[model samples]
Target: MGHCIICGTSVDGVVCRSHQEDVAFRFTGNHPNQLTPGRFYEGTVDGFADFGVFVDIGDSVTGLLHRSELDRRLESLDWDEGDTVYVQVTGVQDNGNVDLSWSIRQSPREFRGEVIDSPEGDRLPDDEPTPTTETEPEPEPEPRTADESRNDEEPEASTNGGSASVEPQSTAGPIDSGPPERVTVDALEESVGERIRIEGRVVDVRQTGGPTIFEVRDETGAAECAAFKEAGVRAYPEVEAGDLIRLTGEVERRHGGIQVETESLKPLAEADAEAVVERLDDALEAEAHPGEVEPLAEDPALADLTDEIADAAGAIRRAVIESRPIVLRHTATADGYVAGAAIERAVLPLVREQHDREDAQYHYFDRQPLEGEDYDMAAATSDVTRMLDNRARHDEKLPLVVLVDTGSTAESRDGIELLDVYDVERLVVDADPGFETSDVADGVVPDDGSITTTVLAANVACGVGDVRGEIAHLPAVSYWEEAPERYAELAREAGYGADAVRELREAVALEAYYQAYEDKRELVADLLFAGDDEVRSLASHVSEQFRAKLDDELETVRPHVETREEGDVAVAVLDTDAFTHRFDFPPTALLLDALFRDLRAEHDRLVVVGLDEADLQIRSTEGIDVRELAERVAERVPEGGVLASGVRRGRLSFLIGEREAVREAASEIAADLAA
Candidate 1:
């Protein structure tokens, strides 16, 4: 018996069972079957494919080192044919096809020991020194029976298919070899019932009251591997989510799926861990060339925003690469949802490709629709608090918050400043025309537009160069009625028909109001990019329901509203909080949109003032400088403490805490308009 190299325990093999994955082996066998499933081998580059590189391991084993297996992109590989590299033989199929995985450690010194896997038994390489002992001497030959002599002479023949119980005296384990062969989480299907090695960043770690489960993910896939120290104990207290690690374990079919029983695990250094992420960033960056993108819109303003769009796209790509979470904050409106959905649509696929975990997209990115007109302090506080909690609990990196459709306005300045306190960089892709996003934004897309925020976000998605074509119809969906001729033409060119576009608009608007807070991802994706003609029917049904709800709510509110002429303005007054459902579909904004559309005439300046306990929200057909109006009101009623709260929604709140004061301010403003 030989001693294990890592623990120095006596064993019958080159490495003990406990440290099997810590060792690498070179296959000298003739057939693929003779090569161990979990062992690494030296190989030569045979060829390359779009999916992976073909590697010739030995005389009979040629395996595919899939692009998904590499820590880097296939395009970045600088290897040529006949060039030597190292890979792990993860599996050998029944048809004799071999599957290979990439190794993070390429040099021989990285491994604990190397052994030759011959047909008869494992042995030391010819270049390596044989194991020697000081205390326990080598065994001498002893008398044996004729049958025993024959069996000893032909151990390979005796064990080939026969019942000869000859345990080959392979010298005990070698020194701490490096980590075992790295396999993709997806490749475990072929390796069921076999011991294998895999390397990945720990996506999640949880305890089952029995064993600690680590959800590890390589580029290709993710799986849960369990480690048990004892009953009801935490196996690896130091192991946490987001740690890059290499593990050796047995792949077993558990719960009708493949899971691993981990034998050993090692955390990889951050410097070495950068390889996998750096490769993904390179691929994402290559896709962002200007030549790859065609046109956002015919408008010169949209054209000018291209550079800013590209910058934001690059930042997003880098965040995903570095495994930093991205928090998407958008206004809770149809325009905002459309914009947020477009970015979400673009980012999820890349997240799935770069990281192996199925849930990494959810973990790495967030699509939270902001309430009201501006990303106010309350919203920012909640977002910062939740993000900090996640960072503390999961050891997650500080998230990059992308403000969609809201942060551009001056109203969001205070909220933006609060996020900046954490040193969090914020990017703003706003469709608002009135206010500049300069002071608070790290990256800003500046342009004037009645164009829906989705179109702007879509342009940003395309700026990334990997934008999905399926989102081509989403911009059309963002428009409630008259889509600009240029945008409509572009949408038509992208295959969005008039009916589908309208249906998508109705459906998204309705969905946006219902769960006004949640992103409603799968539902939105299904409604927007159903990939079939029937999606039109699906969107139409939801849109009709949305419109019907709006119609009923509009009629109900009309009785409570009072309309009268006040100087140059046609003022409509309504007690919003008393008449409208506080938490229901058809938001006050949408209802007012319909009211403004119906009441406005070419010569008439129609203003609708909605009042709720000390809050006044005003919407007008003709443009009103609400900030200037608020200044006027603040000057007129200094005791009221009436200040502009949300510029995007024309919202202002009174500090005096009285409903009568809000009505007085609204009345005074309508009358002051005579000036």
Candidate 2:
């Protein structure tokens, strides 16, 4: 019976067996899976080569059994190109080359092949010679015993295949060691059933009714990590958003989406956080868009804002200078720093100097109504009027500066302040780089009369320099010439003893050296005028004048100048070297703290503020002192604050320098005061 090579079926069983056999010689097909090389297969020889012959299988491509890998010995084999022969798929080279051989052995019937016999079986010869035994003995007949009967049962052997059973693998536990398999930002996509650990900083955090959603961002991008309220509230009492945290969790693709969900989180320390942030920044390339910022000033919204600022400033000045009981419906500072000060300045003097300078009724009304506190406008008015009455009675008028700076903050949307100026009779003044179109549009309503806002372009100081100078020299200039000994004695008692007092004399030399090397300037002039008291005196006067302006403006216009001076004129020495040491920043803070502690012991009621060289204390002052003021100013200013500042901004530098000087004086006098 012939079989179909392609389908592996017997052709004899089919109806068309006779016709199929004729075509079967010309037909071809392939073995299912040819793993071993040098194996021959029977098929029509499709093509020929010097190395091998290609035999066509029923499949599209022919299989080539390489001559080198073949087990056949080809000495002389008469095979036509079209003849059906066997070939094997030999070694498959990476370059898509194939090899073949001719002589090969047929497979056994028991292996996979079927026996092919001749169709015509001739009933010819059945004669065959049988070999005779050489020396055969006599044949004997034996009788079987009754006990050896064939029906007796014999012992049976076990036939069931006894295979060893495999123990099942454990599935219930956490991984012991080694870094968790790292999944990239892209690879995190397909991982649905796996556990993962993500390292990043907590960018944003919000507590919902159910869980706290936190955004953790590394260099690649940000991912969301959620902790249940019960867990998060307990875990994050000491830390907040912007802290560095690591999360380990079973990942669930949210809504079958791509983002990973972390189930647990742990906080990272400052050093670890800093290193991570550094790496992230290196990857992110965070950059400031200076061009973007500059164009913002020319924006239409900014133009409108400038007009409103002018109006607010004009109203404030008129109300303050004219001694009118001003009721500002709305007044806003750009960032609330200066504007807040402006508002306080407007209300303060009415209470302080009102008793003496009563020209008109003095009434001030202020309450942070946002919090629903009832404003005591009436009581404030009575108090102001009484102060004004007293000032008038004493024939004294306090000099006040109406500080007019630019308009609202970059993000402010409130325009009610502009509308209030129109409601009241006041004028507006324009500062440099005046208001934008948006400010004008927002400043007033369309159908109403516009506020009488003036546009003034003048550069005027608030005399704070003069005031600060006067206040600063109050201890020295006031009594220095009259009683130097008494003044020195008082300074020593206040914690600045002889050493600190002596250091003040050497301050000029120190400042000179600082200017020479640090400022990169020739100190020839300073050296020539070294002992010239006249020159030193002039520089001291200039410094005092600048300081006084700040002091006086803050003192007279705003509240009384709150100063925490560590050095006292009564007794002291200055450790100029300690003041100028370029150690890490915190040491500066500590030095200032020690200075303030000593100063606080003496001036129980004074507004103790450090200025100039002793201003380093401002870096770490806890509350609303020079340090706090420095911090606040730094935060409000776009030019980075004291902590985050560069050398050029020098706001912090100025504070630090001033703080260190005060600290030096206090340190020099600490022992003397103790004695």
Candidate 3:
């Protein structure tokens, strides 16, 4: 046994140092008793170098898999820094290093065993050859000296040249290493104001304060092309974002780390041409169906008008009033009613034509009885007096209209003090004289106008006509049938038509609903305020009246009606204003909420909800807030049962309003689905 001089390791070998110019070898002092050669073992590539790979075989020494042994497919095998590949031991040289290979053409178990033959396959017979006592041949002539051998290794001189092979000189010398590595557009370093080429997908094109910018992208990344001043964008004619372009210019970094600085650009048609064609196709298709691409929020005609009015009025007054139909004991009274529209009331004699004084009087009155009627003149007179105290009060400013018709008897004297003989003043009257002082007045009047002063008191106390209460109160059927011309005339003067009337009537219904809601709110407030049953009683009483009124109005309006009910909620979308006088919001909101609850209970789950003008439903309700309404319903709905609605701002806007609730519900539903 001897130690290796190179690594200080114990080994059994002949100690020899055979260092030839081409190869070197070292051996320890020990010799093998029995040799096992040509044995193969699996190995791991441990290290890679330009010339070969070093593989470990669990022995202290490693093996070599030269580049020449690699598969032809990886011809120029440029191995990565860390790659471990399988290899097999091929041979062990006189030196310590082992030779390895990956090819398995030779089976290890079949071809490897003890060394029985020399390298040239010369065999030793079963018995050793006897050594003849032969004198060794005379020693060969003394070998040449080391210097002589070294000189022989030198290149031989060429016949007509200084040296047999001049060293091949490199045009680029050492610096050329190899052909400079080919750089793709992606590989170039990005620097501000540096002229560099890059590629990316075009994402957007929009105008900034300076010029139009379009985004382009390639495999590496995306970049923005700023078409600086004068909008060189036009030069690119059809060029847009997403159109692959080969831009050439000095790069500039702007707005932080974003890099951009373009002097000239060219569209890389091959890369972006397909996308451009697709965009053109899309644009062509859109042109083919122009109507479909509309912004999401658009109101229906009726709704648009409602929104206009609501905007103008701040808070809209929408109401509906139901009245007992006039049996019209006779047709004889119809002519008098028709003629009454053009005739001034008997109070024309009590009016002064001109007002020269700062405090001139304006006289008006509703001859309709208030003794037992819903409207009390004394109360209305008091309201008028309060209005009169304000300097801003005037006839044109007040918006109520009293429908006056001549009843068989007059109740003005009974309920109104100062029956006659008062100072002369101006008088304002309802445009529709058919309403006169009769029982039909309240029935014809909108539910919301029940608290209004008559035209007489309104004109006398405040210089205004109660157009809302009086003129608009004409019977819908009668006005359209009996006095179409007069009704048209009033509509024209009012700067609207039947459509406006219908809208106003609907608005009135909404107002009444709001009032009903307010009444409930007030009752609740009172109950909460007082902590008593009195307010509750008042609320119940008012609700009963409201329901009865709704019934009466429905009777008149639902003559040619159709209705669909989901639960306790009955949505009777009428074709005319005669349906329950007008649309009121409070009862609608409460009723709808109750209906939803009932549906929830009946179906064992709420199924679906349908609404007309869901936008209006959301817009009109200030209490019970639409957001809260959505939340309340969202909480109770099954994963799939929630159905809220809005047709304006976008179909999803309605959902957006309820995002918090929907998000929560969605998370729960998703979890359930996952489970």
Candidate 4:
């Protein structure tokens, strides 16, 4: 038997089957069926066709090089008839028609070895002559001892031409050829500068200008491993995200973060991979849950939702462990901003602890503010498009979408359905009684509007990680009126008094209105969680602007407000388009809320309705089904095309041309219902 050329292993041919693909072949047989698929062969361009080009594998065999198999456009080909080229034989049909594909390596020199394929057998090229019986036979050398033979047969160097330095030896010395003991990523800090082996699943793979970075996660934690081939080239291209791989590398620090310099990375066998997966699943199940914690305040609604809150928190923590990105969507309002920020404050630290990359927090968590109170189709489309792009470009996993202070009402059903189609994990935290529960969400914290969404989110935040103090004041800020006494005391202990919390709420509300679509993470954090001096200074400045804008709007609308008495109910009405800023800060919704609160204080029972050209907003202390009211109005004025939108916030929309008629009918209907 001959020895394999790449490795000194006994084989029937010059190269073993394992390394046969590493070398290219020159087909000498005439029939197409004699060609072997998946092996590269030297060929000549015969001619071009409308669909593809024809390549002659040998003098008698021709194959079609379909345009679909080309890396570039077929018209971009610069080949001339009879020019030598390299192509891979993809398949040979039963009819003996051969199919060829493009090969990046155009010359045989690019391959490790090249041999001729003949009907007799494979053999070396003409330059390397073989010994014949007709010629003189050389004298045989004396047999060497086993030890001497082993010493002489040195391991052949790899000729794959990849730039990765895949030496599996330890830094101190040559380790045993058997698999090394596996180390967890969390323990990598102690093993810096020491070679180690690790087994995990690849969470993400990113190609940089210098190295290919693989974010791998095991039971303990996740870390980045960089494999270098050449500048701007991919290394270990076969390794992909979600692959269960066994990696050998040296732990090192880069830019104050732990990184592994990959020596060798290969996917594990099925049995070994299953074992690793089982281990990871066990650890993840144990660590994904948080310790039992009570709600921040003593409210019946929040107290009743304790288990659901814990489930939401557990999902967020589990996402961090799996290296899945968390996308937070919230309404662009004071309560919404506070609720979203509370969750962000709790999750950022966990992200840092779970990932070794310095930028892991940014990569793993993102917050987005919604323009309207509902998570509508527009918002869902934007989110889906961006996440799909991230998955395609970076090999990132689909993100966990958490909707806060919104997405509870039926208005958000369409958006939630879109996310369900992709099988994305979803969690919703809203205090609106109008919440439409669905089996699609992984977790939901529903309330009867006795508490604000900020309170629910803060409680969930506590269950996620230990950042209770960081977000203690957020629940208080969410309440425009008196916050729960317990939450107020918690905020005081966190160094924020009632006035300070109000200032922060005002600042966030004003900022949230201006850039309604932007998260404004840094600015919001400064307003809520910065040092006392910074928070006081920034919150005071922004609060002053908020008060000025709000007071101006209240003053302008109060003069136009028309008050009328219908039985025991005091009905107040104002033309929003004429009396208030149609497209400015202190939005119509906020203005209506403030006006309704003020009117309620003056009158025993009050209903404030702000009428615009095509929209109407109502606010009342009594529980009213705004959607039912809209349906009644639509029946009375069939030509108005009235529709109930944003039922949780009490909003109605109608055709602009029929606004006057719808307005009159809505006022009469609302009066009768109140009476």
Q: Name the candidate that leads on TM-score.
A: 4
**What's model 3's lDDT at 176?**
12
- The parts of candidate 4 lying over 4 Å away from their true place are 1-178, 181-183, 186-197, 248-264
Name the runs in model 1 displaced over 4 angstroms. 1-9, 12-17, 20-293, 434-437, 601-603, 655-675
lDDT of each: 0.71, 0.33, 0.32, 0.80
Q: Put down candidate 4 lDDT per residue, 1-675, tens digits, no spaces.
A: 666555445667566554555567888998988887767789999999989999999789999999867756777788999999988887899999898877767876767678788877777788854422242355474464452254335432221222123532222222223244589988999998776788889988876434578888898878888776543357777767888887867687654577887766777767778888998998887898875667776777766677788888989999998889999999999999999999999999999887755567778999999978898899999989999999988778899999998877789989999998998888898878656745556555554677889988999999998987688778889999988898899889988889888898999999999868889989998898878685579999999999999999898889999998878888899999988888998888899988988888888877788898899988776766888889999998998889998886789999999888888788777877766
After superposition, candidate 3 runs with Cα above 4 Å error: 1-190, 219-221, 229-235, 269-590, 596-675
Compose the digit string of candidate 2's lDDT tens values, residues 607-627. 222233423222111222223
- Give residue 515's lDDT in candidate 1 (0 to 100): 67
Looking at model 4, residue 637 earns an lDDT score of 90
- Residue pairs with backbone atoms closer than 3 Å in model 1 (clashes): 2-172, 5-173, 5-174, 14-173, 112-176, 112-177, 112-178
Poorest 10 consecutive residues of model 3 by lDDT? 317-326
TM-score per candidate: 0.62, 0.21, 0.20, 0.72
Per model, how many backbone clashes are there? 7, 90, 54, 0
Q: Please provide, for model 3 over 372-477, each residue's C-alpha lDDT reduced to its tens digit, 9 standing for 90 to 100.
A: 2112355345434543443133212221222232221233322222211221111122222223343322212111211112212212111111123233322321
lDDT, candidate 1, equals: 0.71
Candidate RMSDs in order: 15.8, 35.9, 37.5, 13.5
Cα-based lDDT at residue 459, candidate 3: 20
